[model samples]
Every structure is written in C-alpha cells, then in structure tokens.
Target: MSQISEEEKQYVVFRLGSEVFGIDINKVKEIIVYQEPTHMPGSSEFIEGIINLRGHVIPIFSLRKKFNFPEAGDMGKTRIIVVEAGNSTVGIVVDGVSEVVMISGSVIEKPSSLLTSTVDENYITGVAKMESGLVIILDLEKVIGRDMAEAI
Candidate 1:
C-alpha cells in the first residue's frame, strides 16, 4: 500500500457546540444517524451506552458530556461518528457532521496555551486555519485513552 504524507492529510470535521473539531479522515469508519443506545450500568458518564451496529457491539460516547457542555436537546442534526482507534471501534456523538476538508500541514499550528487550558490539552493535536474559521484537530487515541479504549 502507498503511504500518505503528513501534508496530504484530510480531516472529517464535526461540531460539538459552537466550536468545531476535526479528526483524521483515515481514522473515521463511518457516520451514522443518531440512535438511542442501550444504557450500560456502571459505564462512564460521557459514554451514552453501547449500540449494536451490524451485529458488532460499539460503545457510544457523547462529546458534549465529556467536555462538560450543557446537555443538547436537539437530535435532528446529531450524528454518531464511528471511528477506529487501535483495535477498538467506538462511536462519538456530535451535534452535527460538517464537511470534509484537506488542510495543509503548513496551515496547522500548535494549540495555544490558552486553548489547551480551556479545552482538554491532551486530545488536541493542533489548530487548523481555514477560510471560515479555526478548526481543532483531535488525536483519536488520546481522546479515548488506552484504558478507556481497552475497557470499551
């Protein structure tokens, strides 16, 4: 297989609240419409629950709850972004799924100290400057840490 260079990377953008975030397109498996997942007792608060997708059980996580944002009431635009990180396949709930875009490495900047402190510093890989506005790039593995990844 041919390797894709860092500069040629593409991202799947999604919105959590008013803020926008992006994940490497390579890590995204698929995007699915919102569905209520079966609640699992003793699971993390951020994790909505588990859902059976094509016979495979997948854990569903809520970005809003994880980021401590106010609960969202609208489900019309909500989407479950199924992403593959390592050997685990999980889904993250986002307010909406935005368009995919290619962002050159040169236009990506390290997360500012202010941004890192406000948002979770651990998950942010960088900030990409787009014509519309800035988009935060997230590292999937970091967002769902090793422990959580393995557990779910």
Candidate 2:
C-alpha cells in the first residue's frame, strides 16, 4: 500500500474593514485596482457582475457584501484579487492584498468560538496569531459555494 502524502497550499491575505482574511493562493490569478463592475440584472446582490479582464469577461465579487459587512465607500487601496472558482475564473474586490503566507495542513487548526459569533466559524479554517494581531484564515470553497449552487 502507498502512503498518502499531504498536499501543500498557499494563501493570499487581504483585508476587509480592519480584519485580515486569507484565501487559497492558488485560487488567485491576479490583483487589480478598483474598477466599476458591469451589473448583471437579476443576479445575486453579492455578485458585482462581470468585468473585462484582459479581454476575458470575468465576474467580480465584493467580499464585503459577501460577509455582510457595512458598506465602506471609496477605499484608497482597493484591489481586485482574481480567483478561479471551479470552471470559471472570477475577480474578488478586496481592500488590499498583503504578503502571501504559508500554512501546512498539520498546522491548520479549527476555528475558535470568537469567529462563530462574528461569522460562521466553519467559513474559517483557523486563527493565525501575528505580532500585528490575528489573521483569520478563510475557507474560499465554503464561502463561495453559492456560485455553483446558483448555476444549477
């Protein structure tokens, strides 16, 4: 029998309000500054709709609206963190992208009670303590599960 090897993953960290959130780095394709998204009528409000990304019409998602955060107007450092969700590639608008961080499967921990009240802890992989404070590791698949659901 062959021994199962753990897969390594990288994460791209970005900020929502003051809190830091990280998504699978592999999901990220590129990051762009804020640009108005062409609205898709009848689509879910969370989806900011498609944008012309390098001649490819890629949909954009507002993470703030996704997590139910109060609307923040005109961020000086807003960026679109491009992510590929399943078959389609999409860009997610975030406040900004911090440096990429590493986390091994062995070090990943379950979300604590603190995140539960804030948002579903299941959406969080674990809490990473940093000298700056704490960074909440996010589960992109669970959070963006709605996209595929809507397609059906």
Candidate 3:
C-alpha cells in the first residue's frame, strides 16, 4: 500500500485561467520567469516548446492546454514550474504561483463528486480544505502521463 504519513506536504497554489488549483511542492523543482521557449516540431499541441535551462534543454508544457483551457500570453507573473513526474522532469506553465502551503495527510480529503469540479479528477489525488476554500491536489503521474520523450 502507498503509505501517506502525517508528514506535512507542501503545495503551491496558482490560477489556471480562472479556477484556483495547487500541486504538491515536492513536485515543483523551481520557479522561473516566463521565457520564450524554442519550438520543437512534431510535438504534441500541449507541448509549448523547449528552453535551454542553464545547459539543460528543458521542454515547457502548458498546463492550461493540457486541461483544455484556452491559451494565454505572458501578461502577469506567469512562471514555469519545474516538476518531476514518472521519473521524468518537465516544466509546467502556470498563470502565477501564490504561495507554498503545508497540508497534513489527515487534512487531505477525497475528491467530492461536485459537478463543477469534474474537469480532471484522475490528475487529482485529493482536496485540501483551506480558509479561502478548497485547493485541488494534483496527481503528479497523471499530469505528466507519458511525456517522457519531451522530458528527456
């Protein structure tokens, strides 16, 4: 069984278009300013492009696109969240990162079958109830899925 201890799990919250969401801080490698990524032909639609991250050619993918949201240009504090999923590291673009929050295992609740929250349940492991509301905890594996090619 996958053991989920009471250890505090940090999460970074951000907005995807309009909805607010979050991912485990452990998955977020680093936060970087928005940069024009170099295009790589024959890649998936969600794969925005790649960039040379201090000698490491990191491919940046749009999380919005992956969730079927309309594309938006870098206007505000758009950033690339370096993440490791399925043993592969990749960059996920977000509107802006709010703050790193700590959530214990006991506080994490199973996803409610709320019709409004039906977008990507599989990519979500649980929901963290917060004073603001509830922050969706994403599943790292499902977010990256099979994007090993671009990640490598």
Task: Using lDDT, give the best candidate's number.
Answer: 1
- Across 1-152, the per-residue lDDT of candidate 1 in tens digits comes to 12223585889999987899999999999999999999989887778889999999999977787677888878899999999977888999999998999888877887766876557877888888789998988988888765465456
User: Residue by residue across 76-137, what tens digits does model 2's lDDT show?
Assistant: 88999887776667778888888887755554456767555667776787766555666777
Stronger candidate by TM-score (1 vs 2): 1
RMSD of each: 4.3, 4.4, 3.1
Can you write out model 3's per-residue Cα lDDT over 61-112, one digit (the tens) per residue?
A: 8888778877776557888888887766788888888888888877767665
TM of each candidate vs. truth = 0.91, 0.84, 0.86
Worst 10 residues of 1 by lDDT: 1-10
Clashing pairs in 2: none
Displacement of the residue 140 alpha carbon in candidate 1, Å? 0.8
Once all C-alphas are superposed, what RMSD does model 1 give against the true structure? 4.3
* Model 2 lDDT, full chain set: 0.74
Residue 37 of model 2 has an lDDT of 87
Identify the superior model by lDDT, candidate 2 or candidate 3: 3
